[model samples]
Target: MAEMIEYNCPSCGGKLEFDSTSQKMKCPFCDSIFEIDTIQQYYAEMENSDKSTMNWDTQAGTEWQDGEADKIGVYSCQSCGGDIVADSTTAASKCPYCDNPVVMTGSLSGDLKPDFVIPFKLDKKAAKEALNRYLDGKRLLPKVFRTENHIDEIKGVYVPVWLFDAGVNARMMYKAEKRRMWSDASYSYTETSYYSAVRAGKIDFELVPVDGSTKMDDDIMESIEPYRFNEAVDFQTAYLSGYMADRYDVSAEESIKRANERIKKSTEQIFAQTVKGYSSVVNESSRINLTNGKAKYALYPVWMLNTTWNGNKYTFAMNGQTGKFVGNLPVDKSAAIRWFAGITAVATAVLFGLSFLL
Candidate 1:
């Protein structure tokens, strides 16, 4: 077991501190850097890694006693080379000044690495405004929630994600049937013919994205889709300077499996579209290749706000850096019903008057 918290400056031998906003445990003394990957290696070298890794599925989660000294002592920020003081138990934070997501960098002692990460670029004020604008256009919402639901407390969080790009040289062989109809004087006969063909093409999927946390579900992450991978700069702690970030808990190996599943589904659809008019089908052969596999441990931005409506928790999220709106909205059902009923009654009266006039 390692010390619960430890800080040392490698460059100047001065004390170091973790910056929650920058997402890096930086050596304020020397600006020398390190990331969570270093800690994982440290413990792994000592064969004492289990003390740091926590199972997300468990209720107690990580069993990280607030001050447990046995936990992995330190994490360095990969982006900034800063030393980050991570709660060996908790998963998320931002650097105090730089806004980098200093997260646990790796989980694998075996073979796996992230393909890529979409960094956070939007700031807090911009994210809040995005949520407000999303609310503004929505009609039939409670006036209170529209205005009273304060976004002041919306925490800017950057989630972990995986990105993968593959070149698929697809060779699909299938059998298909086409239908034809011919009309006699009084009746029509329909005839169907079967055909066999092979379709082959190469598609280069630039960057298919996947979210890497069970903390927030994939559905919401997908909702805020099309992360601009081309705009992705090399992962930097400065990008996380003013936002929160979660370390990668789900493994890259696990997420790559998911990415493959998505690719398979997409491939099937593409082939189906190409081979139309098929009553019954058979894909005798299919091929896909993961070309130029690249992965990175990255932090994505999200604005999480926990609001209560009638004793239930309604969590709201806006893309912290992009300002994309997400999360379950808080609503007053009684107010919604009243508004609907009132509108219905007025509409009914108008319809009745128009009918009478006609």
Candidate 2:
């Protein structure tokens, strides 16, 4: 058995769970809500310990082996006493049996500290509204999916990301041609001139983000990017109070390949813009080299929803900072056929009317 601890309500000795709506600990049986700060103070007084170090653990999730059960901690739901095996990076989760919010405080305050974080700007209500707007104006989406999708689960999570900064040295060669045509006194003349274009430049990129969690889909995750790095702030444990967070399992070295690809593409596009005043231009050869490349760990806020319809799972994600939403919806085949038929009938009627007038 792993270490299990329960939080009982102070008023009725009932189990307490964190409420996302009110941002407080609530007792289901008694319907009593308590402030987390007050509860922390009380717990500190009872235990006769330092208040600042309540959730701090200097040596958490340093190493794990195949058979090392000690590395994993089983959290017991305060409401139902149900045990949940939370991995090293999972900061908050709900109990499987009772669905009560459980915060693994010890998991977040360890050696895996992030250098920066972007706090959530939008709440649960905003996420729901964004989902409704996303479903609108999409004719191909199934009608039943719209009505039946009650959103099985919606969570606000801080996804781990690696930000890379690098200086680039790039050189590119291009073949350019200029053509002139003239016709005078029944004689046609054409002149073609060819030139070589070479460009060499150095540029620096700051804070190119790459997803660090293996559970997240790279392509889908990058779809909602451009997280305004200027608004980022230094990491503080207090931000993790009411939201869920994940730690980095993929190291910076492993994520360099993705960062380099984007850097190379951007470099080529920037240099290509300088070539002008030519009828045609073709790239002959190109090379981009990266130097002073470094990576920093950070957390970005996102609101995610997961649902299943007709045995197919749909994932919707919203940028918590910018309120951008993206997801793939199932297309209705029957509705598509009806739409095509309706268009054909309308077109045929208009064509017949025009022929009668002619």
lDDT tens per residue, model 2, 1-358: 3322345678997667555456567777898988767776666576576533223233565566776764466666656656687776676666789765555666545557788888777787999999999999989789899999878889888888999999999999999999999999989998999999999999999899999988777776698898988878777544554566777778898998899999999999899889999998898999898984668888888889999998888999999888899998898999899999999999999999999999
Error of 2 at 201 (Å): 1.1
lDDT of 1 by residue, 48-68 (tens): 635555222324336667757
Best by TM-score: 2
Error of 1 at 280 (Å): 9.4
Q: lDDT score, residue 125, model 2?
A: 93
Off by over 4 Å in 2: 1-72, 76-82, 95-106, 183-190, 337-358
Best by lDDT: 2
lDDT of each: 0.59, 0.79
